[model samples]
Target: MKKYIIILSSVIIIIALGGIYMKHQYDERQEKNKTAESELYEKAKKRMTDYINANYEGIDKINFSNNYKMDQMGGINAEGYLNGDKSKEFWGIYDKSNNIITSSYVDAKEKPACKEKPCKY
Candidate 1:
């Protein structure tokens, strides 16, 4: 009976350790995924910024939404405000081709606009 009890306890300890290790591994994977996602977003933002700078020029104080629409054809659509004015909204579209991200932007017609200065980007 004593030998059986020792065996059972040892098995339980082994199972607990295994569970802990598995949990640690799962946590590490999640962290890695989050880091990768952050990096991707930064790169996308950079592409969008380049597009804005090349076309718009002389734009100050811009804000972009954290959430963007993604399509299966490797396109991403993003929305943002210009010159800290919510009414002055715009949309940017990014396409990925051959590992290169290209971007374009347009004024948001659906959203209402204000006659604010320094809001054209």
Candidate 2:
């Protein structure tokens, strides 16, 4: 009876330790993913802002939609309104090569057809 209790206790301890280790690993991965996502968002914002600054003059308010999508090719598409004007919608794409593919300000009432590959949002 004593030997059986000792074996059972050891097995329980091992399982508890394994569970703890797994939980710790999962937390670490989540943190790392969060950091990576933050970095990506910042980079996308900066590149989009740069594009706006270079093209549009005397514009201050740049509001980005909290909803951004990542393409299968590791590119990001960010959409927003220009100067807080709902009518003036902007869509920017950040490619994998750190290149700003397109930044377009379109009339919110009508979204033009996407003719080319990787068309507007």
Candidate 3:
């Protein structure tokens, strides 16, 4: 009886260790995925900025009109002056140039506009 009890305890201990090891492996994989996603977003943001600078010259104070999601791609509509016109509108992709180059325009739910403080238009 004592020998059988000892064997059962040893088996339980081994199973527990195996479970812990699997849990650690799962956590590590999730961390790696998160890191990769973060890097991708950083790259996307930089690409978007560079494209805007190269294509849209003489435009300043550019702001994102909509919330950016990491899981999906979208576009942002910007309102700014071009050569002091103060009436030009720019609609382009969030982090890609293909949409802009192909002339794909996405309707922005909330358009960004220049505003002054104290309710001044």
Candidate 4:
């Protein structure tokens, strides 16, 4: 009876240790995923801003619907679209302060080449 009790205790300890190890691994994976997601968000925001600065001159305010469709394109793909869409109203601003253009969304079109100031979207 004593031997049997010892054997059962040993088995329980092993199982408990295994469970703890698995939980640690799961937590690590979750943290990694969260970090990756955060990095992607930052990259997307930067790309959007750069696009806006290059395309429009004298931007004052950028307005867009709340449904900005951020998920459809991840970081790299979203940057590509910003580079390509000339007509998309992705940025707006009211004034250039300290040579900085501020907008709600990044407009990703080349500064208008024509001499006449382009019409606001």
Q: What is the Cα-based lDDT of residue 113 in candidate 2?
A: 35
* lDDT of candidate 2 over 1-121, digit per residue (tens): 9999999999999999999999999999999977876678778888777766555545668888888888788777877877778777788777747466554553333213332433322
* Residue 102 lDDT (model 1): 45
Better of 1 and 3 by lDDT: 1
Model 4: what TM-score?
A: 0.51
- The positional error of residue 25 in candidate 3, measured at the CA in angstroms, is 0.9
Residue 6, model 3: Cα distance from true site in angstroms: 0.8
Best candidate according to lDDT:
2
Candidate 2 residue 96 Cα shift, in angstroms, is: 3.6
- Candidate 1 vs candidate 3: the TM-score winner is 1
Instruction: Assess each prediction's global lDDT (C-alpha) against the native.
Output: 0.64, 0.71, 0.47, 0.49
lDDT per residue (tens digit) for residues 1-121 in model 4? 9999999999999999999999999999999977776565454445445545545566544333332233332322232223344455553332222223233444333465622543333
Least accurate 10 contiguous residues by lDDT in model 3: 112-121
lDDT tens per residue, model 1, 15-89: 999999999999999999777656666666666665555455346756888887766775666668777888877
Weakest ten-residue segment in model 1 by summed lDDT: 109-118
Better of 1 and 2 by lDDT: 2
| Candidate structures ordered by lDDT, highest first | 2, 1, 4, 3
Off by over 4 Å in 4: 57-111, 114-121
lDDT of 2 at 38: 65
